[model samples]
Target: QRGECCSIDHSAKLAIPIMVAKSDGAINQLCQPGKKRRRAITRGQDEESQKASSSRRVTHSSVRSDGGEESFKWILSKRQFTDDATKQVIDGRHCIWSRRRQRIGEFDEFWTKSGKSWEDLTTVKDPETVISNFIAQQISVHATNANSNACRTAVGMLFRIQGFHEERINGFALKQIMKKTSCNYKEEEKGRTNLQVRNPSEAHTGKS
Candidate 1:
């Protein structure tokens, strides 16, 4: 038995505790035999190797601020929001129209506060309904119907100028909603006008 070991030697190896240094700089004593200790060491080495490989792979693409790899979804979201052509168009509008710039700012603030991504328009279920509800919600916040209509128009223009297709913003549904809103505004105005005209006549008759 050239390299053979007796039962006593094997028992001695099993009785000893092996100290293993964790990746976090902590020492963990493993009460394992030779075979178990070897397997544990191999597993730890494999994990380190995988992590190093991941780091190397990330160097070929954009890195996040936190030193992590940029995910495809994150990259796509950034591109959609910061596209060069879209930025130029928006900048031009801002320079030419102060009111437009303000309205666009409001829309941007609303969108950012909602915590939604542009991708959600296409990816979410019943996007048309979702978009309609969002538009309605925005319009409801204004004190006057005219201001509400202006808010709706601003949101639509912003979506269009950002290169969103008709389908993306549910154009047909939006048109119908706008038509309804306009009719409602006219009816309210007419009622107020009639009341103003009638009030003076009644006052004159009472005086007579």
Candidate 2:
């Protein structure tokens, strides 16, 4: 061991730097370039996604299936109306109406197909014209004349609560649809009555 030059192990120096780096928390920074910038980028993506989710303005809709009424809540945006008085029309507005008579989705389609909704029925400047279109659309779906009339009545009630009067007891288009349906019903009834009278034997035997 005299000429062995003290046998100093060079490998031990490599292990010392690694240990120091770990203690100082610089190993991560050294092995990964731009570690701080990468973390900042990740934060940026998360913030961007958060902002997008926050800015999404979709309206929420929920309806019960139990053939019972459900509460409707709409938070009035302060800036949506020009004055507090107008805003009062929407703040805490609640309505409990029959929702099981007809599918609200079909009714919603009736509005969406006509460029409106139950919520926006009174918001439009020309509800008469819009409703005329809506009624016609309903009839086009082959909805029974009575059902079409009922929908118009429902919208009129919604309007009244929003401080609007019925444009007319029955709008022009609605009156026409009702009249046409009424005439058809009368004719059908008359035919059935005549048939029943012609076959009294069949009626007595319950075979008609």
Candidate 3:
């Protein structure tokens, strides 16, 4: 036993400072190298931090999913202002009217391809529910995220000026979608700026 190595008690806390003194030979004998000790402490800290971060991420994701579903439902519940009296309200505004016509053509074409008529929207003044969903879906999926907010805003204005109920176009539910679009636009622009900074030539050439 006199020549044997001392047994290490791995479970002991090592946070206390080692004191070199006449009374502390046992502490000095059990001490590990500073780098290894620091690394073990850091590893434990990192694991704990990662677990907390993962929990936060899950909660955030759940909240986001629920909010998105509610917003989508609200947008889907909206009805288009297709009354005969209100139909021509935006006709004098050439650009808005043209956009509306374009949207209608696109919506009808989409349904026609699926063996459905645009007139199938006759239920519940439902001209809006499908069209609103279609516009949001198209813009969100097809339009560049950088222009997401602008595209939604432009189409949303068409609903507003055409004399739709405020909640039909500018309600809190619709605003949620717009808020998401604006956030995406900002994120996209930020990423683009970062990419350009990292590789100006590649960005200019549109290579990545």
Candidate 4:
């Protein structure tokens, strides 16, 4: 037990609190809304109207400085929704999209809310490509220097949490490819770091 004693390291435990893990968009990252976006809790508002709406979702609107401006900026549902009114269907005892995200088949659609309009992420035939491209673009500017694998996995998890899954969106394929990419990139970065440490003179001259 050299330099080791039972001090009850909480990190070593199998389970950790959501806040402790800083998962699902961190504790406060989601608080900041985009210029035209507002995060409103679905209370008091026509929460019942959602069930009757063809969209089958709550809408968040944009506001102006001088007055109140409204537009369907985003779908504020605990579940996922598509522009396709047909997507709003009841599956057995639950909304097709609920606590469990399901497969929307090969032609699933994801409506990404940007500023004024919704970006249909599923315009392409393949959802996996869309997921990979989006993650690749995001990791380059992420707060943490995340690799594609982590970024892709995080986005995929978010979609799943939003009641979307399988071919309905990117599935295991993107994760597997990015996982291998992350491993290879980590190995390369480690080799470069070790080379610099082993030969400081070579580090400056760009020689290994």
lDDT of 1: 0.54
Candidate 4 lDDT tens digits, 4-46: 4433444445346645667656635665554225324444245
Over 1-208, each residue of candidate 2 has an lDDT whose tens digit, in order, gives: 6445334445566779889878778757675778777998999999999887766622122332111111111212312444464435434333424332233334455666656554574465655565566666777767776666666664554344444456543467656766776676679678777768989777566575
Better model by TM-score: candidate 2 vs candidate 3: 2
Full-model lDDT for every candidate: 0.54, 0.53, 0.53, 0.43
Local accuracy of candidate 3 as per-residue lDDT tens digits, 1-208: 5334232332232323333353377656566566678999999999999999999987765554443333222333444534443435434455654334443444444445667642343332433454456557767566665344443454454345434665655556556666676687788889889889999999888878
Per-candidate clashes come to 0, 0, 1, 1
Over the full model, what C-alpha lDDT does candidate 2 score relative to the true structure? 0.53
On TM-score, the stronger of 2 and 4 is 2
Q: Could you tell me every candidate's TM-score relative to the true structure?
A: 0.43, 0.43, 0.42, 0.34
TM-score of 4: 0.34
Q: What are the runs in model 3 whose C-alpha is more than 4 Å off?
A: 1-91, 111-122, 125-132, 139-141, 145-163
Model 3 TM-score (2 dp) = 0.42
Mark the 10 consecutive residues where model 3 has the least summed lDDT.
6-15
